[model samples]
Target: MVQVHIARSGVQLGKYPEADIPVLIGAGTVRRTDHYWKKGMAYWLVIGRTYDPPAAAPPLPAASAKPVPKPMRPLRYECLRCGHKANTVREEKPGNFLMEICTWLANPFVGGLYTITREAGKKALCVNCGSEHMTEEVW
Candidate 1:
């Protein structure tokens, strides 16, 4: 029995028994252009020129892939500071007069723009303690 060493570019892939060569090749892990070396070989040679097999066969079928399930996203906010079930609030702020006036003076088209804000998108104001902070977890 002879041992064969496989390499790609200049990096050695591994040393394996001669029997595994065809399987590795058929499995698509080893390519034809990859270099091969054995005990009697003087130098590394390409697998395509050196390795003689009956005929090229189709690659072994890989195991069927199963879809990975995604993690469930949190639906509600629970206040950490006061331990209260928090509510989600969408807050819109009216345009600031100062900014509006400045923008109006600068350009009327841009002056009418108001700041679109989600002030409490993920944050909750505790009804018990009145502390405004991010919720600890989903309600």
Candidate 2:
């Protein structure tokens, strides 16, 4: 199922009304490209010109311009030192922004796969080591 991320609400709308949503000239979503669709996603919804209310209705409430929460992919990586947990790389789910931090550095992750992080300074060492010399920064 395609996840419909509400950009204004920061909510992940995993459930769609159906397999495909009708996009018009005014609505906020529109199909932008066909490249990924060929990759075998269940569905997709791209944002387009936002639809507004008609003149007959009352003024719409002011909604906070919060960013929507995109779908997150599972990730696993071990620390090179002491064999501990390290940073997680979560891929962007179908029909969402790949730029989201949660979706960054992700590679088509699957279960039962493990790769320890490259060896670095003591700062990158695992918590079990309790190293005194530490430099803070994942990069």
Task: Please report, as a residue range, the 10-residue window in candidate 2 with the lowest summed lDDT.
Answer: 110-119
Residue 68, model 2, lDDT:
80
- lDDT by residue for model 2 (1-139), tens: 5533332233343333323434322253433221112124464334432222233667788788788887453323444444544353222232223333233345424111212111121123344454322333344
The TM-score of candidate 1 is 0.37
Regions of model 1 farther than 4 Å from truth: 56-139
Best by lDDT: 1
Q: What stretches of model 2 exceed 4 Å from their correct place?
A: 1-7, 23-46, 49-139
Clashes of each: 0, 7
- What C-alpha root-mean-square deviation, in Å, does candidate 2 show against the real structure? 32.9
Q: Largest TM-score belongs to which candidate?
A: 1
- In candidate 1, residue 138 scores what lDDT? 51
Which residue pairs of candidate 1 clash?
Answer: none
Q: What TM-score against the true fold does each predicted structure earn?
A: 0.37, 0.14
